[model samples]
Target: MIPLAGWLLAGGSLASDPAPTQSDFGGAGLWQTPTARMAEEGELSFTANRTRPYSRYNVTMQPLPWLEGSFRYIAVTNRPYGQPSLSGDQSYKDKSIDLKLRLREESRYLPEIAVGGRDLGGTGHFGSEYFVASKRFGPVDASLGLAWGYMGNRGDISNPFSIFGSRFDRRPGRDELPDTGGEFNSATYFRGAPAFFGGISYRLPSRPLVFKLEYEGNDYRSEPHDNDQAQRFPVNLGVVYRIRPHLDLSVALERGNTAMFGLTLHTNVARRSEPAKVLDPPPAVRESAAGRGADTAQVDWEAVSRALEDNAGIRVSRISRRDAELFVTGEQTRYFYPAKGVGRAARIVGNEVGGDIDWFTWVSTREALPVAETSVELSRFDALLAHDIDLDEFRRGVERNPPLPRREHVLYRADPPRFSGGWSLGYSQNIGGPDAFILYQVSAGYQAEYRFRPDLWWSGALNANLLNNYDKFRYTAPSRLPRVRTLVREYLTDSRITMPQFQLTASRRLGTDWYGLAYAGMLESMYGGVGAEVLYRPFGERWAVGADLNWVRQRGFGQDFSFRDYEVATGHVTGYFDTRYRGINVAVSAGRYLAGDWGATFDVSRVFANGARMGAYATFTNVSSRDFGEGSFDKGIYLSIPFDLLQPRSTVNRARFVWAPLIRDGGARLSKRYTLYTLTEDRDGDLFHDNLDRIAD
Candidate 1:
């Protein structure tokens, strides 16, 4: 099965009923012209296109109904990457970010309208800005747009902004310096002469073919790297072959001279569903209340505890019964969704209790600390077995809140596991850097955890390199700031068999609405630190705030376990918010960085229905662009995919992949192994909203 990963951008239902198609540039458009169209929300695609001297690869995501974002890499085959001695025979590559916003939706009397910018906040290689409108007629989609800069090199129309000042009369030429480009040049935006462009798409009914023609605003009179090519005509023609629902092949003739070929892979994350858990054991049969007897001693607590762990994915901490309610306390381990654990627990307890117990409450815990609890009316649950009530009706009768500090009538205390470990394979890589196209390593690793108690534990990871191509990682960019993150090459090549991280961590419940965490020892591959954090998150609320502080010393290149003389103190005060709409989350952190720089970071992401989070983050500080080197700032994109999606049995573990255009030394944060916010997410009440469908399963 193909893995579907995504990131945020504008989105909406496809225009004109299945009208939007992936353009050669990987956006929704026709050939070289953009249209006011969008992919369905939660849609993502990877596209590669080639035309003459240029080859472009793009990854586009639509996380919202009115936003779209794309990250692209353009390789100019005709130009050298840098001095031949540094990058021999390597083609110059430019990495850029793009965004499109839908300003107006199509209506009976108006065309859909959108505004966007290309190669934004990056090198001016293909920088441009435009606003376009698109409408659909029977079997055809039409789009018209006005653009500035590279896309409008034809200069067919005067700059509309020229009325404001003479500064708008000319577009600043791109700098010829060999420096890496990533800073945003706002002064150059919408400043050049403009041009008008239009295009149309023709789709045959009941067929898998799509035909398109576009009037391009860019002429081949001048090009990036001063490599201009001749054009035979002003218009472009293209065709798309839909080989499968998620795959497309494109062929196009642009500039009447250049032949283009492209491929696109697409998927929608919002509508994904997990396969039925046929292998999981069925819920225990409901019992007759009168037959179980009214005496509590008749209950086999040990047997019931084992059943909960085996059948409901919950590891029991303790069990107790009040006048009419039974409370089971533990952490969910097997079900990726906590609600599923709750549902299964309800079924298992129904078979153990009788007429005496009228309600069931599960106190969910993490690190043996109670975070939240859910109470369910047994009568409502029993009705589901009799088909007299639906899951939604039963859900309405349930109640949940923060865990209260009290214990009574304790029946059983579970024996917690003391030791756990696992073996796995790992792969890491560096890409799109000017020095080399890719530098990678593969290894076999083992991770183990030993819990002294439920609230305290020691853990470590040891890895042995199996394969790597770090020989090509010879260049290290000079940094005026401390080398906090740029020494990645030295760490990777220092040792073959090494333990990069070894730490001891502990967590505690400070109060009903607060949590505390602390850790010490070897923290990560680059540094060793001791840190503590406190979080104040209300029970079942949508927002939280936290603060953390740490003191760290750089690690030796031996990579096994050694410290360097360099040390610093760093931390952040972070705020987290959940919009409660489409799982959109926004996070901001401000404080001192690893390099002793003051800055703040902004992260925005969307959590899909399938336990996947797609997000991007950017960090800026007082460090100047010249001192920060390439990238001008710190930024990257990441996708965290739930383990359950790749296997039959459910597991909450996730595999994360990160991509950064360049690794710099500024805006670096301490890599804390565990965070209180994530540890207590199950208490936020989103668990039920995200996993409500599992209630009846």
Candidate 2:
């Protein structure tokens, strides 16, 4: 039997093994020793219980003063799996790990402030979890937490309900249960929710009673499979009773996920230390501004991705989930004439937003522009505001438009702003291999523009495609990158052109960091290109240098089918530079085109960074394939710098600038750039100029 001397009493009762009273529920306790005392703490607890057909075991330990960890693993090997079991068979297993740490605080301030991390055991599917923080001041305590969680089961539990009742003969001789339901994949059961939870609780002064309340819910947009856009809120109330000097019991009824009845025992690890009366140190004099400490280190892209899905189920399975969003864009270009239309100025504005909820609907309106232009403006605005709202994720989506598309053309007054309204929808699901998945997307949009060559002309394009990525082999275009980011490759096609194209790509790991890949895509445009590249890593590292060779052919209005005139071949050597502090990557290349167009190129970017990031790009191309234009060795240069303006403690501010100069014949060709800004969460606008050479000439 447990000793009773270590335990204290509440409300005049002194039972040998006391039950928790209402006071102990929320952090309320009567002083047993001195009113003000210092103390060290260490504690451990283990519980084993049998809830009818199933048995559970749980353990909690605190190895450090500010850290608490808990582990719970459950296994049931019975046969009756009806009702809650879903699977009639009787084998269910799950394990979870939870860790929490307290932050440092002054003696007079709240000391219960803490950060929490959780990882579900290798049971359900990939791992899923959340980050939470809480604080308590005097008789009041409150907490807030964000959770990105995936709920799904892992390996099949031997539950009678899960067994296929029709397929297996089950004539008293079968050992393995036949695959009946065929819906065992975790994807079928797992649901994704982005939840925010916060609540307040208060204690009654001088009484053994405490009152507490909380609210929790998720904000989830529609995905390819599930379109439920709903939020949940629950409430809870509980009380605790202190039996002896060392034992405590508690019970609570909650409408939310934490609803449970639990009993706890508390003991003084060591006698409370005497209160100290040390003199307060004088405040240090303020000096010049100092670099913020690591605590001020901002959350980068990698941190956000890791927090999204970190679970055993997610780590083990090869299933992927995707979301489809639709948006509309409108932009206008203005041109400024230098003496005689030598230079032009332009401006672009757009509003985009749309999503589907499972049962309802969701919509948002925001602005978007190329990265180079957005980063610059954001930097100035960030210095003005005081918060950090991620704008890079949006910038990333806009950069996929090939660098030269529409950017090389000069603006005309007769033409209206570049106004386009388009819709894009895509969805992808993963198969069961380690990293296997299938994806598809359909996009169609129209733009109204006055064609300079063909006066008063308008045109539009429609797009549709499917892609697959499994543990075995996958295929995509050269423009496509690995789908490691969000399970979806941003490119519509690979490196090859795709009016209507098909491709197959496969790769295999040779060791740790070494891998080999092969890809082939068919093109439908009048012009087509066939190319292949090999990647090699001598030391098996994440970074590597490689070379590629490509031969292309083009058919123009007048083509005699001559190699010297219509066929072209080129070779390029490539290397990558990765930056961690600034969250950027630079890919540099030196290549030669058969048509005397040989130059070096560097494509660098500040991918995910705090404050702001800028990318300076420089490229020179001489001579162009007749298909592009009728010109002799032409020299061109382009530059763009991007950044994220983080307010002191608010959403991000963004801006950027892009400039390209081309020297043809003895003058500049289409020399100009643009600047874009996104001030509101879902609003965007921009300003641009053309014929910039007028300033130089």
Models 1 onward score TM values of: 0.95, 0.25
The number of the candidate with the highest TM-score is: 1
After superposition, candidate 2 runs with Cα above 4 Å error:
1-40, 46-57, 74-91, 103-113, 124-128, 150-193, 204-210, 218-233, 256-259, 268-697
Residue-wise C-alpha lDDT for candidate 1, range 543-587, written one tens digit per residue: 999999999999998766788888999999999999888889999
Candidate 2 accuracy as TM-score: 0.25
lDDT of each: 0.82, 0.29
Candidate 2 yields a Cα-based lDDT of 0.29
Task: Identify the candidate with maximal lDDT.
Answer: 1
**Candidate 1 Cα outliers beyond 4 Å, as residue runs:** 1-19, 176-180, 278-295
- RMSD per candidate (Å) reads 3.0, 28.1
